[model samples]
Target chain A: MKFGVFYEISVPRPWDAEKEKTVYDNCLEQVRLADELGFDYVWAVEHHFLEEYSHCPAPEIFLTACAMQTNNIRVGHGIVVCVPEINHPVRIAERAAVLDLVSGGRLEFGTGRSATWTELGGFGADPDVTKETWDEIVRAVPKMWTQERYAHDGVCFQMPSRAVLPKPYQKPHPPMWVAVTSPGTDVDAAERGMGALGLTFGNMAEQEKKVANYHRIIQSCDPVGEFVNEQVATVNFLYCHEDQAQGIATGQRLAQTFGYMAAQLVSAREAYPSRSYASFGLLPQARRQATAPGEQPGVPEGLCIGDPERIIQALKGWESTGTTGVNFLLNVIETIPQEEVLASLRLFGEEVMPQFKEAPDANIRNARA
Target chain B: MPIYGTLALEEYAGAAPVTGELANEEWETDQAEALTLSYEIDDTYRLEMLPAALHPSIPLYAQIMVRSHGSSPVGAFNLAEVRLMTRAGSHYGGYTIGAFANTTESVEFLRTRYGWAVSLGDIALNQRHFGARAHVEVDGRCVLDMSIVHPQPITPGDFLVIAGFHLARVGSDLRLIQSEPSYEIEMIQRGKPRLTSIDTEAFGDVRVRPQNPIVATYLKGSFKLGRVRYLIDPTRPATEGTEQI
Candidate 1:
């Protein structure tokens, strides 16, 4: 499986203007080094009004910076909120095309409807219409890229035919992806013939099941764009070191804070806003843990943490799940220093990535024998 | 303590269905004048008042005042209530924290039919030349009294953003009580609201946080209650050629 680094660009409470700059600079520096280290992608998110949990409302700017600074690592807009209110489809099309041009066509246009109540409610965008809006926007953006002059009369926009300009450097357009937080969103991506940008953390068993369903469904997909991006990418946390103890302790702490920050924005669980949110699973997982007294809650085994051996073992589990790529969330809650983060990336590239990179060729030879 | 999405059906449940919709489907209400004032609340109120099923993250407290002369199960009357904004995962929902009406029948209709934990109280949202004011008093104590002025009116969206889900169990189906209230709003003005009176802990003990009063909108048109829908996540967000219901 291909290796990529993901970013939420979190800045915990007691935040100020300088803290945000430090976070951004640190992320950029990490991206530059990851590209040099031969990492495949650098993914980031777009969230608004979520406070310190995720300060990245505009990710296209950062991705553009990545494009200008790095030569190899694909810059990913892990997602650009697709709802019309949050961002008009027309604006997204224009911006994405320009970015792809600058990045020399290494762009993954991932899209999603805003999940948090703070974001949805703040923008005055209706949750009821988000799914419909997301589908419409995702389908329309690619056409805007390929077609010389694009015009549409759809549920979201109605205009007399006019040219949507700045077609990308990619032949048709950059590969399209949709962010999948819930289990079923994977199926949505498959059916629509888009790439599945898996946002939720899951174990090998869960990943295997999800990926199997995805590959099965994608076989008959009638794509929204001209071609299907048949790639399955899932997220994982990474903290690599020679010392197994240090890696687990540091990585797990960062992972806990990662979960906490995510929970803060979306967890109205056990409250009125979360009445329908029970399906999101974190609360349900916690509730089930409450049932079995004295049992330590299972840290999601999907993350590639621990020393090189343990990290390789964990990643091998994910590789068996049929994922095309693994996006590793590198720094969370600022628990790991920037220098340590760079060191971990360096370690991952030097020791772990080579095996996975060579495994496909080895597998082909074994099949032949 | 982690406040993300949680299943809140149980928290919102326990209010007996008063609409009698299961028995009959002839209940409809249209043409009403109302004023709604919304506020942002602290985490304390968000955790305490809303239940786990709701996955309460956005702490919303709204006071709605209505005067209806049109048609409904209650014929014609005046009523009002306080709604707390909630969410069931991604879906927006609300709880009737406290409610009050001028008439006794409306009070019973609200509680027995709509499941609002309402008590007898005075509620009004009035247009006073310069601005609009919302005042609510449960029993003898004033719970909500806030106003906004310099009515800089604009075209309101087709529907008000204030509506949310009312989680109810009708039989075995987990019905997400969806509300799409359309307003023939002749006026839509947004501005800073000034709270002159200060008594948040008078009524249901669900304190109205005095800090951040976010955005306020005043409407002068008729309101219509839309049809309710069943709340099913479909176990996944993927669609298999299934048309949206």
Candidate 2:
């Protein structure tokens, strides 16, 4: 299974002047370290003008820098806003190609429509049209890469025959992925023949159900993409230390805070009028409102806090759930230091990755049964 | 050669306080949280912040503006590298922030402030149309400081013209007060008024508008409409003429 990490570069309220530089430098160092550590992929996100939650508004620059710094880990646009208003398709192609070339062909193009109303409104994008825009632009990328000149006419965007150069390293285009937070989007990705970067924010059981649903859909998909890339990836909070209690205790509040923060931000623009409306423990509160309090968050739910063994157990639950890959969300909310984050990565790579490091084809075959 | 579609955004410095998060695992959450905090706490709004070394330090601002539904030669009257200019002053200043886009959604189209050229990588437009263009003026003088579709699409039908421009952070918050449009968004939407026309005797020599026009509509940024052109920059003109192409 492929492994990747997500970056937000948060500098929470009561900001320190040096916070920004430190976080960025540490990130750069992490990418360099991941490269040497035999990690598979390094993914970055693209966000615009949001305080505390996200600082990396321009992820391409960061991704490009990572491209130059590392020789292995496939750089990812964990997502580049595909909406024309946020980013035009042509620009997406150019940026992806440049990153691919700079990184010597290691680029995975992940795309999505901004879910937040603030971002949608800011970019002048129609919230309803986001999904459609993502599909159109993503489909257009490959054609742009392969053909010297092509033209398009659709509901939203239209282009004439023109050469789009600096094609990506992967033929047709780099590996394409669609970030899906819901199962419907997962099935939708499968329908389009795109890899499901499943952002299934649920327990291990829910993830398994989602992955099972994806596999079924993919097996029957006509496949819009060049190939049937039916991989399902899930993101889980992670923090590893030699001392299990220290890892859980130190990471508990931070990990829970991270989960609550992520859920709040995702639901914010739709939930409340302002960001301060984000109260701590909102996720748990929302869960309580929706379900029984005694219920666990999910198998892969809550923070994967503990020693390496516990973390492995959490991941294995997800693996059984049919997850093709895992995007271990280390450093959630920044309670841990860089040293710990790296050590966690090293430990996971050494202890966990090996357990699943067989031939991917074999794994898929075994999982299929 | 890497043919880049270079364009410019005039007068309006796209957005304020180009904020960015570091590239770390928490990068996603940090950015989302920080942005949410700013929107919640700060009274102002920011636009078009994409990471780029275009200006070494300054981030690229994605500005959306209204344009005609046709192919227009996209270029500015002039280009230069100015330290910084704004609505209130030459440097740190104030702004009359206005919201643009469909009413149901709080969409704000970014306008240009200064005359600066930018490379938007090459792109093409299809299905052009006609319509009235949206304007953001300063002191009644039409600042050529907005995004003009130098290389836009040419077809038939009104469009919700969208373009991008360069900008720098002005202040923490530029309080926006929305007033009635001096003209009318509906009229522009329905009547489809034409701003600067091509093929005119005076502007004929400019090669201003290509034979076709770009359609302006509220593209929902949807992908269901398969194989659509997300962005179009006519500035990086095709090597061959329209007929040949």
Candidate 3:
């Protein structure tokens, strides 16, 4: 299966003026290294006001930097929050097109409604209507990119007929995806004919069921973009080393730190109960896996967080789930040193990546073809 | 790094009376009806309300619950509590700020057995044609008056209630006891929350100014207070200090 690096750009507290800058520089260096190592894509998230968890409020700016610095790696907005107050549809279409043009068409446009009240409430957006707003925005953006001019009087926003300019570098526009966090979101993606971008770390059986449901439902799907992006990519943590124990120990620190920080944020369902948010987003799962009394947290099954052979076995299990790719979180709060992270990436690239034969963008190519 | 709570453990421990044993037995309740109202509070005081072992929840909020027990070992009683949402390490739970019960026996049972910060109060939970309401009074002053207006029927599964964290003096040590109650819900309803009155000072913290009303729920359920499975040292991070009981 194809592999990619995902970034939340977590910056720990007691921030000096240069801490965030150093983190960004280190991430860019990682991206450059990944590109050279034959990694396929680099994804970044859009989050807000989440201290010590995610400082990446502007992923477009970050992804654009990634695209400019790398030649072959595709830059992905792991998601742009589809709420109007956070991002107007036309602006989203316009910015995405510009990025696609600048990146030489190497853009995977992912979309979702922000799942936390820390972000949604900050924007004064209504939690009850985010689902409707996301549906409207996703539909309207594809049309905006394809048509000569677009206009709509929709529930979320009204726009007079105007050319949403700078059409994308990709022929029918870049592939579309939805961030699937809660249960049944994979179905939502499949029905819209978008890629299912799995954000939660479920077991192999759970993932297999979700992938099965997605494939079953997409046969008669209506495409949201020019063609259906019939693909599934799940998220995992990666920290490969020659020594299995050392790699696992470091990886556990990364995982636990990430889980700890994630729990500190307020999810939409926790703060505001609504039918729009079906589950408590991703925080509770992370919280459940946090450190308990007198016991060390064990590595989750099928996680890519060990030596080359172990990671290879884990990825094979994921491949059996019918997933197209794996997007890995490489670090959290800079818990692993930068040099170690780079070495881990290099080792994974040299040892683990060669074991898989599928082209990184094979699904996208086939869908377009 | 997660933000730790800044409440002084020594001062808090000194104020609390040593009651429950370190090893306590589990307790269960009969059929119960509860009215829960939650509201977003001023986050400036979030950290101050919790001990060092905990972390303030993002978008700081508080829950006011008034529950009426149909039958218990201490006979029938009405209970009310104010809890600040917090994170014990990574688990989401509420930290008890103040608790009031209608009966002396219930108060004594809760305080001496579970280390609840409970006192005697006049409390009532009533159901109206429109919805449900709860009123709590202490020292002849109305401390809480909240309601669920025009509550609409909702699936029992939709109501997500978190666990409660009580600071108790357990066998000469001040520990943060985890009180998780499992509810077998029979019926549940949701409605717009209305806070008619609240004395923030009377609840032990004037900084708990309710800014936005989140939700109100009324549920008929049989709940069992499970055995205390964990405790946390109030002076250290929960990750480094939690102990299995």
Which tens-of-lDDT digit does each residue in B76-131 have in candidate 1? 65565556665443334455555567667766665544444555767676778887
Q: What digit string (tens of lDDT, one per residue) describes model 3 on residues A1-369?
A: 778999999997789879999999999999999999998889999888888788898988999999999999999999999999999999999999999999999999999998898888878888879888988999999899999999999999998999999999998889999999877789989988899988877789989999989988876677777888889999999999999999888888887777777777778877666777877676545545544532333346677888999999999999999998899999998999999999999999999999998765545533344
Say what the interface RMSD of candidate 1 is.
Answer: 14.1
TM-score of chain B of each: 0.71, 0.21, 0.95
Flag the better candidate by TM-score, 1 or 2: 1
Q: What CAPRI grade goes to candidate 3?
A: medium
- Cα TM-score of candidate 2: 0.56
Over A1-369, each residue of candidate 1 has an lDDT whose tens digit, in order, gives 877888888886578888888999999999999999888899889988775667788889989998899999998888999988889898999988888889999888888876665676667765546778899898888888878778888997765676887888887677788988654788999898888988877667888999899989987787888777777888888999989999998888777656544544533222212222324433223223321111223356667888988988888887788988899988875778999999998998888988787335211111111
Task: Name the weakest run of 10 consecutive residues (lDDT summed) in model 3 chain A.
Answer: A290-299
TM-score for each candidate, following the candidate numbering: 0.64, 0.56, 0.95
Q: Scored by CA lDDT, what does every candidate get?
A: 0.66, 0.48, 0.85
- i-RMS for every candidate (Å) is 14.1, 24.2, 2.6
Q: Output the lDDT of residue B212, model 1.
A: 52
Lowest-sum lDDT 10-residue window in model 2 chain A: A290-299
Location of the lowest summed lDDT over 10 successive residues in candidate 2 chain B = B28-37
